[model samples]
Target: MTTPTRARAARRTACAAALLLAVTALPTSTAAATDAASHVEGQLPSGATYMMDVPAAWNGTVLLFSHGYTPAGAPNPAQNGPDAATKALLLDRGYALIGSSYATTGWAVTDAVPDQLATLSVFTDRFGEARRTIAWGRSYGGLVTTAIAERDADRIDGSLSLCGLVHGGVANWNNTLDPVFALKALLAPDADIPLTGLPDQAAATSAANALTAEVDSAQSTAAGRARIALAAALHNIPVWNQPTQERPAADDWDAQQANQYQAVKGLLQIAAFHRRQEAEVRAGGNMSWNTGVDYARLLGRSSVRKEVTELYRKAGLSLRADLATLNRAPRISADPGAVDWMSRTSSFTGKLTKPQLSVHTIGDALVPVQTESALKRAVTAAGSSSLLRQGYVDNAGHCTFSPAEQLAALHTLEDRLTTGKWRGTDADSLNSRAAAADPTTPARYVPYRPTPYLRPYDLAHHSDGQ
Candidate 1:
């Protein structure tokens, strides 16, 4: 069979292995109650209970996962789906799996970590008694995992941040600015108006929503969606195929890759820059042209806090609105644009000083593999470069690894955590398996087209046949 066919087959085999292992992993104590292996419910913190699987004779290596963020009504907001699949895979190998619904639903980090820890504490009290703990989080969860590692290193043994938002603050972390501008740049001819002007919270949201809505509309038409998806595929191919330094914003991305511990100098450089900027702003500085600072002032911290506080109230996320007030400042922005700008190499590089492993699809559109490099850098900087490892998968969606590749990567991580060994990137295994899956057919490399027809990047950026 072709490489793609082989890859798909390997993935299937991996999934089968995980399932088989899960079947045999039930604790002897609960073997008779195998059906009870999963005890799920809502509880303390936010009453956001979870579904979990506890294995027999556990190795005491607990993997706590933090789910990625999506809008409130996202189609498949089920953290349990991936959690269950992963738990079964790991449980069979003598590990326990636990997932927490972060303290809040939105992207704000103020209390998200604390609430997650508290929930973890609850999980520990009830099921796991492991002294060794590893945290795994994706996207938003990845950011929270780093923050937790920074503050509660004593409680965490290691961290695996995947497709995490390592960019500073909530604003820059979301890539609000680039997505808008990129879309505008690419779709200007088709767009009624150029998507520019100051970042008015209302206007920005309106524009994004409008664009997203259009994409959604076009998505209903197979031909249109197919064309748009093709364009997206083309945009990512270059990043995957090009050398790291040759990629867009390579310096920014490389800075992100330097380990936090080893790169104290770099961290200090950026931190000092942030501090200097803060001072200037406090001294009546002009907000940089990039921040759209004037527009930011309109919604500012106070307004965002109120909005988020109320969102928390509605979502049952356990965080105090008073905390928002206490933390409010001009520098404190939750705006997606601001967050994305700052996230490049701020909090993670300075604060994260622990051994960690990160994996990402080279072609990820949301959280670029570049961010994963940043996490690896922080680990290396911490002087524990030996303790960290990275794996890149080919022809994969954001975090969707082919079965064999996923298994190999996880095995590598397990080996590191258990024995402190290093194996080079597992990209080869994944590529091999992916190739095998459908030697003739490609895996899903294209993104979904916008239904209503929003802007997308140009074909020059990626590899799909435009």
Candidate 2:
């Protein structure tokens, strides 16, 4: 971990350049064909349930799947693949798949890893030893996969993540905090909108409704829109919102703000209002704060800074004055215990003990592409860059990759695991491989480099802006 000064310095250095990886094609032996499949389901000692699928003629390779976040008390059903189509395809191709319900669901990282390992043990007890186990996870489960990659690499041959929050829980929450803090500061300064240290869901819901009301009202005026743009900039919310709509043209501030507004609204609907509150409970207190953040500098690093500035200028607003207000606004300080829990449970060392591949849509609103940037930095810092490869899709949603794309990534990891090194995994190669896997499915891999993840937090840089 670097000192606060050094961390901020590193953040600057990272934002100066982006990583634009080119694409390449792939070889398509995802798995060998198999016969009928058998189903297995059971529960762990921790109350988490698990499910598995083993083909009549198995390839001895097990794909250990980890599902994304499920709300607390929700129907925590077990998952053995990304979706039914992919699960069926993998089972048909002779790969055994397994996953668990996890003891509890909201931000279930701690429960997931242990539950997954237990499920694997159960599978081995029932179905016998797998020739090789490949760990795969999505969203928060992606964080679980990376943790497994680091702490339990010897148990798995390779890893794959989809739309994961790899920047760790601290940064993930901080990303949410930036928008809410800014929006509250500028829009509802006197409102009783609670941002952290929530006591229950009732408080969170009430606060969420209040914030949403403010943002909806704020969108109607030029002055209000300017302030919203500032908040969006600090949060690094992307200006391109609609997946089907063309990317907003440069200088189209109105179209851009409209798009950012969608993300802004989404930010309120997601982590800002719910997960942060939920996470505080999980961590035993608040896990996010903004005591020393530099709003102007943060905006400067945003991908949409130019658009924000344009909006502010057109609105005849003072960007400098607003930034000053943000800097001067009362800051939130995280509870030390909560911070410790988040750091220990969700942080990434970037040290990949096994070959890992991750694919994210370029326009992912929730788990932004910037997450990949932080991942690459961490990997590079740990000198594990060779053990990782990332690809981007030309799509614009969270965990939105089609089955073909998902399989293509799996095949790539399989190739690396089978061989002692990686083959073609570039955007072009991934797109081509995905098309080969399923022509009907769209494979929109494209060359992309993401800006540095703003406001990244870890134990080493725990003081963050301070």
Candidate 3:
């Protein structure tokens, strides 16, 4: 089977494992309840560390937080909430918070699911069971939370994913591969840059440094910048990078390309290469392939095609020539074993039985906003659209949500769990809610509908054609 069958394959693998070790869910007990505020920390059999915060009031609800990616060799701190401000608010409101720092970092979805389940076990075993368990995650953790919602429906009540890579790992790596691959063919075709099969983290850094030099050099000329725009377009990466500035006007091609160039420099050095190397190591081999892709067809579907075209015309360069270069470049191949492993461990079925609400910033570059679009398609395919609601905040940066905006999304999910129907999820309603709740911070919720996901895997309800 092709990539389309990954969801079914993953679900089957998850179910078989679920049968081996039961997820412990206990009945709530007044006898086990504690009166005062408390904190608990412990390590699981896998050496994964977990931390929990219980409020004084004990509201009988627990919020499970799954954190984003932590690159290898960096400090992997355990998080009890998305941010400090959010953590304080949740605890002050009588909600218990808990999270785990998984066994290993970087592309850890294989360990994340079981680590989360074990954390829940530790929580329930110590205190009584929570009356309602809501699972929330940010970035990569958001992917983990959704996977849990799909497989452990009986344990988790609802979910909230913030700035998540919800399109799953395979699609993310493959999509990112496109732009960097194009960058190699156009900017530094003769340079010894290994786009894939990076042997170690050091090799990945070396490759990123090489590409970084190429991007810096390309920024000097209009022709080179136009080529860069074409690559960013193919990746569907947004061209807005700065947090203090407003999004560039649609007609401002130079500003957009400038943003793309700046944004892409860091992306290539960090996420595009570092994460790929780690993932390939964990998956036992390369998991991305670009063997038969058509570059022009992808550009034809991109949202920034006009921007790219206008920039190329102004630079007196042939857009078609760059496209030809990318098409003729040798393609990367995926290992069958690694592909199968990542599919079962890192991909999502979107077969959710629990209610979930996901929110994304419309201007996100690190984890592109279009991931939400891909997720909705996957959920709909599993016949779970009725249980899913999505919201958008007008902002930039990855997981750069304010306390107010974050709380607003959380409250909406709570309302859904209470009402059993989605209401007031529109931008106006959410903006009003954010302002009413936290008047100090600014609210930027806006109506948004993401464009077609350029690398959507299996969101169509019926077949692999999507």
Every candidate's lDDT: 0.43, 0.82, 0.82
Predicted candidate 2 versus true structure: per-residue lDDT over 99-201, tens digit per residue: 9988987988888899999998887655556778999998888999888998889888899999888888888888888889999999998998888877887
lDDT of 2 at 227: 87
Q: Model 2 clash tally?
A: 8
Per-residue CA lDDT of candidate 3, range 1-466, in tens? Answer: 1242553454456458753212223346331344467787778898889888887677778899999998998888677799888888778878889999988999888778788889988888766678889999999889988878877778788999998988877778788888899889999989999988999988999999999899899999999999899888877778775686567998999988988887788789888888899999888998888878888988998878899999899999999888988889988888888877877776677788888999998777778888888898888877878888888887777888888888888888888888988887998888887887677787888888888677776533332212
Tens digits of per-residue lDDT for model 1, 333-439? 23334323333222544344456666666645544454544454445455556666666555423565444444454455655666766554454543454355334
Per-residue lDDT value at 353 in model 2: 80
Clashes of each: 70, 8, 0
Give the Cα-based TM-score of candidate 3 against the true structure.
0.91
TM-score order, best first, reads 3, 2, 1
What is the lDDT for 453 in model 1? 8
Off by over 4 Å in 3: 1-32, 459-466
RMSD (CA, Å), candidate 1 to true, equals: 18.3
